[model samples]
Target: MCGIVAATAQRDVAPLLIAGLKALEYRGYDSAGLAVLQEGEIRRVREKGKVREMESQYLADPFPGGTGIAHTRWATHGVPNKVNAHPHIAGHVALVHNGIIENYASLRSELESRGHAFTSETDTEVMAALIGERLASGKSLLDAVSSVVHELEGAYAIAVISDKEPGRVIGARRGAPLLVGVGIGENFLGSDAQALIQVTNRMIYLEEHDVVEITRDRVRIFGQHGEAVERTIHESELSTDAVERGEYRHYMQKEIFEQPRAVADTLEARIGPHGVLPNIFGVNGDELLGKTKGLHIIACGTSYHAGLVAKYWIEDYARLPVNVEVASEYRYREAVVPDGTLFVAISQSGETADTLAAMRESRRRGYLGTLAICNVPESSVVREADLKLMTRAGPEIGVASTKAFTTQLAALGLLALQLARHRGLDDARYADLTAQLQSLPKKIEKALELEPQIVDLAEHLIHRQHALFLGRGAQYPVAMEGALKLKEISYIHAEAYAAGELKHGPLALVDEDMPVIAVAPNGPLLDKLKSNLQEVRARGGELLVFADGAASMDGNAARGSILRIDGGGDFIAPAVFTVPMQLLAYHVAVLRGTDVDQPRNLAKSVTVE
Candidate 1:
């Protein structure tokens, strides 16, 4: 993922660009840079680190200007360094771009033949050179960007500024997200609204292949057909408090603790004295599911894990055949697309490249309709989907997701209930499930109370080099999520297996030094899970069990470490059980002194495939 911000304002725009990049820092990047048009030239600064390093340089020697573009780069086509950072300059044009140029190889060869010299080994620089070449042909900045965009391929959200085109910035988007920030005596462009919310909340979300030209007092948008277009400017409701860590150590910790309110917010207004509300989903629920014969869930990373949990819920309740596939792999394979299958894509940030591409591929293969279960309201996936279910998790700043995952499950749970009700679920069952859904926020709060206990348990497993997680039925996906959290932040080698799969292979890795954590919720598989714990103990594995308070386990030498937390219920247990696991990973990473919020080699959003 990368971030881009551009501003043309009445006063100093370099500071605003810097602040905007700082806001977008949670998106993740290895290097940062900015280009400002001043005195008939584009002045630039690039640094190979977080935005703080660039800010320090700015403070020491400020790049003062009223029009500029900034970028935080997550390397894709080349090594991350000052040369490979963004705000790439060519001739008189300076540009910052997010997303890849798949045709860069051919374009670079053509440009080289045309005598355009390259400096950095980045696809972004190639676009800068192309745009600069177009400008060199005596074309205006707006026309040059419009003409060049028609010749480019793959996903890109780019902002360009040039000394030749003073007092203006040009932006274009296709596949990736770009928005124009409306401000008095100033107009801005950013990869997301969060970066510009402090400056102005009014935003214009550019549609795919739309080019925008912004000046101090004017903003014009052009469609791919070279026709002028008007995009609505909506006010963002996100406040500054959502992005701050008021009392928590890191955003991850803040997000983990905020799950109660987040889940509550997601459930608000959708449930009442009546059963699950109709049309809670953006589309008509009954009409959509009535024609849907099967379901396919596509996602990546934590969102994929959320889909895995929903598989159990939807199949058991809705009685529809469900297939969950990793979006990165699903798009590449020549997979089967059943007739009348409802395609659902899940992502916290709807800009996830693989999931978005998979959604497009599903449409090409002619699925009944596409649904996007995402957190952002105006994200690419939401805009493209036939139906949209907004996960009200707010802004998840942590690279390793916490509240986003739970809120997605909450949304998917609502979707499942909608399908089940359409399939003729009895009133008693519906009321019971609805009541449980209403109480979910309180149950999540109760789970959050176990953090101190989880932190204490973390002390036992902090020294672990390897760990094993086990669960049965619906809890199996929960086990996978726990393992993912452990490995993602703490750098511990962890694996999850269905309790029955222990004897199949993973049991051989069990030993006293390795910790085996089991999610043993009270259910039909409780007995089976207890036996799996026994197997681990017999193999000399140090065992930690997160079990229901009433679910008794005989404490032996290795079984003494039991984390007693309630499983809210069978339906909502996955969301409840996720809290302790998150706390464990957070505490272990804290003990290990790892970056709990920005973990190594990972970006908060994968905007590029």
Candidate 2:
């Protein structure tokens, strides 16, 4: 994923462009660059590092202009360097792009044969050169962009500026996310709404194959066939404070702490005086649940782990068989869609490439209905799905995804309750579940109080070369999520298995050198989980246990380290236990001196397959 922002305004746009790029830094941060129209020519500035480095270099030797485009790159094509950064310029045209160009190699060869000299190693530069060549032959900016998009193959959200058209910019999107910001005397384009919310809350999200021409006071949209198109402008509800780190050391930590409010916000509408409300899953929610005989969920990364947890809840409460599949793998293989199957796609940023493709592939296989549970209302998956549930976790700036994951679980919990009600759940059971869901925000608050203990535990694992996370039932997914968080941020080699399955193969590696982390909340499986811990202890494997306050630590007294966490309630323990694991990963990464927010080789969103 890369971040793209363009603005044409009456005042100098460098400051706004730079600020927007900073807001979108979580999407990509390998390199930063911008292109401004100055003195009737394109002035380009780029640097090989974070946006702060590029901003500092620009302030030292500034370029002034009222129209510009900027980018923060995750570096898909070439090594992360100035030559591979965005805001790539070719002749009079400058462009910034997100997503991949599959046909760039062929196009670059064709352009080079036609005597067009290439400078950068990025595919974005090839696209820019193609547009510049078309513009050089007398086509208008919009025409050149429109022509080039048809020739290109792959997902891309691109913004281009040409000196031939002094105050005009053109943007196009195929399969990646792109939005146009509406302002008083200016207009903007960016890959994310958070990047544009500070300047303009009103935004127009471009659909597949839509191209937009933006000027200082006007914006015109066109379809792939060059016909005029109309798109609605929606006002964003995100506040500026949501994107700022505030007093937190990093956005990851701030987001981890913000889970309480974020989960509360997600539950604000689903729960009421009686119980979980009806139609929380959009218009025909009750009817869809009634007709649904089975459920299938597709997602990637943290969202996939969220789906795995939901599989347990849905099958337990609604008495429906559930299947959870990785979105990327699900899209490639032939799917088995049974009769009356409800297909669900889960994604934090609705633009996840594999999830969107999987949703389409599932639709092609003829499911009864499709549902999208996502944070972004205007995302592609949301627009394509028949039913929608918005997580409302405002602007998760951290790449590690703290608030978004918990909020998705909150939404899924509401969905399970609603579906169970349709399956003839009694009012008392409904009320009990509702009460637990309503109490979750405060329970999560209590969980946050265990941060000091988690920090201490993290201190012991920072130097460990490898680790194992063990859980069972619902906690198995929790264990997988913990392992993912550890490896994602700390770069520690970590793996997870069901505690009962530890004796299968992983127990062989369980010695004092490799620490074993267990999820031991008080439940029916607690004794069995303890037995699994005993097995590890027998082998002298160093252990870290996250246990509930009610769970007895006497058995684990002489074995290894034990940290007590508020189990919240029976149904809500997963949400509560999730906090300490997040804190462990966050603190461990901090101690290891690794990039907690922007881990190497990972982007916030997977916009390319």
Candidate 3:
């Protein structure tokens, strides 16, 4: 992921650029830079650290200009450092970009033959140099940008500035987020809504091939052939407070408590007035439901865990064979998908690198249809899919991901229910499952009340060099997600193993110092899960369990520790149990004194491979 910001006004705009960069820091924090127009020349300031470091360097000299662009990069082509940062320039042509350039290798070789030299090791530098070459050869800024974009072969949203056209800027997008914000006497361009949210709520979101010309007092958008196009502007519904951490020490903790409302928003549109699951798409879904022979779910990281739970629900309810693949590794293995295969991709940011690549590969292989369940509307994944469902988790600022995971479960659970009905499996059994889905909001709210005990456990949190996550059935995925959260922010070496697999290899890692968090909810796998828990105890590993009160906790009652999410059945308990695990991870990271929101070496989106 990368963050981009630009401002064009009659007065100096470097201050706005700095503020915008801070707002978008959640997306990326590796290296940041800013470029401004000088007296008929281009001036730039950059550093290989957080936004704060770059801002401190800029405040000394302070390049004064009425127009500028800035970027914070997550880095894909090269390592994260000042020499590899964005805002790459060749003379007057400056470019700040987010997303990958797939054909950069071929282009770089061609540019070298033309007696042009490069400085930074980034694909974006090649793009900037290409534009500079075109502009030097008696071409206008608009034509130069359009010409270079035609030669590029992958996704990018680029904002270009030229000293020759002292008061203007040009922006273009193909497969990533780009927006233009309208202000009183200025205009803004950003890779995220937060970058321009404070300056102006009114924004025009760009689509593929849409090129925008920004000036001091006017913005003009056009198509490929210079045909003027009208832009659609909408008011942002998210409260600025939604992105703020109210009363909580961190945004992750606040988002953990917002799960009940988030899940409710996900279910609101799907539930009909008569308490029936309404059709998502008016006509496209029939083709999906009637012709689907089997289902394939693909994703990366936390979204992959959501797919893991979906595999169980789709098979148990609809009797359809389901295979879950990690998006990064999905297409590398040549696996056969039957005819009428429905490939489903799950992503929260929607710009995930491997997930988007896997979805593109699945489409080329003649899958019946591709579907995506994500949180951001109008994302690349949503535009590519045959069907789309947006998770209403609002803005998830935390890089560790709390509310997004819970909402993914809600949306996928609805999909499973709709699939079961189409397969003629929606009898009393199906209705019972829907009732449990309806009760999920309540169960999640009750689970949020367990924060006190979780915090108490956080105080006694084991600073283990290594740890283990144990579970079975649907809870197995829940355990994986727990371990992922713990490792992502806390930096503990945590691993998730199917509890049954404990005796195989991981049993060797268990010791008195290794704490095992067992996600053993009430289910058909309860007895087997508990037996696996005892196996860890026999090896001197400390046991911490999340059990169901309705189920028989007879033996586990006398065990090491209990944090009960007690209630609910196999169909909906996973979502309920997920809340407590999120809280536990948040508390543990706090105890460890780590950055909870912007975790080290991670970004909100994965725009490049």
Candidate 4:
């Protein structure tokens, strides 16, 4: 994933571009750069690190211009360095791009044969060179970009600025995301709405193969066949404060603490005093979910783990068979989709490339329909799906997701309730489940209270090179999520396994040097999990358990430490248990002097396959 921000404004646009890049920093970038058309010349500034570094350079030596393009790059084609950073330039053309150019090597060869020289190892540079060549052949900037896109193969959202075409920027998207922000006297381009939200609340989400050209006060869009097209302008509901890390050291920390309110926001109006309301998904949600015989849930990374938890919830509560597939694998294989099986895609960004591809492929696999569970209302997955459910987690800026995961669980829990109703679940049990779902925010709040204990536990874990997370039944997914958080942020090598599988192979990795963390909720499997913990104790494995408040830790404290969570019921424990896992990872990452918000080699949204 990368970030792109471009603007054609009446005033100096350098500051706006920098600010937009800062807002999009969470998408994960190793380097930053910007190119501005100043005095009919393209001026460029690039940095090998954070956007703040480029901002500092801009503050010292300003690159003032009325039109500019900026980028924060997550390296794919080259090493992360100033030379390889974005704003790759060729002649008068300067550009920033997101996503891969599948046929860049051949394009590079062709360009070289035409006497074009290259400087950087980035495919973006090849694209810039190709556009420059087209311009040299007397093509307009828009024509250059639009025509070159036809020759390109693979996903990309690109913005180009030329010194010859001052006060204007050309942008195009195919298989990747790009949008336009409409302002009073300015227009903008960004990878997503957040990049331009600070400057404009009005946005136009571009569709596939749409090319747009923006000047100071005009925006023109073209369809795939070069025909003029119009797209609806949506007013963004996001405020600047939603992306700020208020009172918290990092975005991850703030998002972790915001889980309670986030879940409440997701559940707002969708639930009533009696149970989850019908048609919360959409007008036809009841009819589609009612006829569903089976489900195929597809996702990646943290969202994949959330789907795993949902498999447990839907099967246990709704009495339906569910299969959770990693979107990357499912997209490339021929899957056995039974009749009446609904395909559900889960994603925080809703633009995760693999998951979106999998959802598109499902349309040809004889599935009943597609349902999108996502946070972004205008994301591609939501726009394409037949049914939609918004997670309402707001903007999750942290590369390692916190609020998004919990809100997804809450939303999926409601889905389970809806399906259970169709299965003739008793009225009294439905009310009880609804009551527990309503009270989940308080349980999450109680779990957040365990941060101090988790902070203390981080001291013992920061120096450890490896860890093991254990859980049973539904909590197994919770354990997997915990391990993912630890490794993602703290760089600790962590793994998770079902507690009953200790005797298989994971047990051999446990020893005094490895810390074994378990989510021990007081449930049907509590005693069995305790037995598994004893196996760890026998091998002198250091134990750190996140246990229920009522669960006994009689002998556990003798050899280990216990952090208690006031888990009100087993039905909501997954969301509650998620808190300490996030807190521990945050604290450990802080202690290890790692990037808590943007972990190395990881991006917030996996937009590239």
Candidate with the greatest TM-score versus the true structure: 4
**lDDT at position 165, candidate 1:** 81
| Quality of model 4 by C-alpha lDDT | 0.93
Note each model's CA RMSD in angstroms. 1.3, 1.4, 2.3, 1.1
Give the poorly placed runs of model 1, Cα more than 4 Å off: 556-560
**Model 4, range 1-609, lDDT digits (tens) per residue?**
799999998899999999999999898989999999999999999999999998898788887989999999999999999999989999989999999999999999999998988999999999999999999999999999999999999899999999999999999998889999999899999998999999999999999999999998899999999999999999999999898888999999999999999999999999999898889989899999999999999999889899999899899888999999999999999999999899999999989999999999999999999999999999999999999999999999999999999999999999999999998888888888899999999988988888888888999998999999999998999999999999999999999999999989999988889889999999889999999999999999999998998998789755789888888787888888988999999999999999888889998988898
Candidate 1 C-alpha lDDT tens digits along 109-134: 99999888899999998999988998
Cα lDDT of model 3 by residue, 11-43, tens digit:
888999999898888775789999999888888
- Compose the digit string of candidate 2's lDDT tens values, residues 1-609: 789999999989999999999888887568999999997989888999889999998999898998999999987899999888889988889999998999999999999999988888889999999999998999998999999999999999999998888789899999899999999989999999988988999999999999999999999999989999999999988789777789999999999999999899999977887877788888988788789988999999999999999998888888888999999899889878899999999999999999998888886898989999999999999999999999988888778988899999999998888878878777787888788889999999999998888888888899998999999888899999999999999999999998998889999998888899999889899999989888998899888999999998676636578888887766788888888999999999999999898899899988998
Q: Once superposed on the true structure, which residue ranges of model 3 sit more than 4 Å away at CA?
A: 109-115, 222-231, 272-275, 281-287, 333-335, 557-559
How accurate locally, in lDDT, is each candidate? 0.90, 0.90, 0.86, 0.93
- Among all candidates shown, the one with the greatest lDDT: 4
lDDT of 1 at 264: 88
The all-Cα superposition gives candidate 3 an RMSD in Å to the true structure of 2.3
- The 10-residue segment with the lowest total lDDT in model 1: 551-560
Each candidate's TM vs. the true structure?
0.98, 0.98, 0.94, 0.99
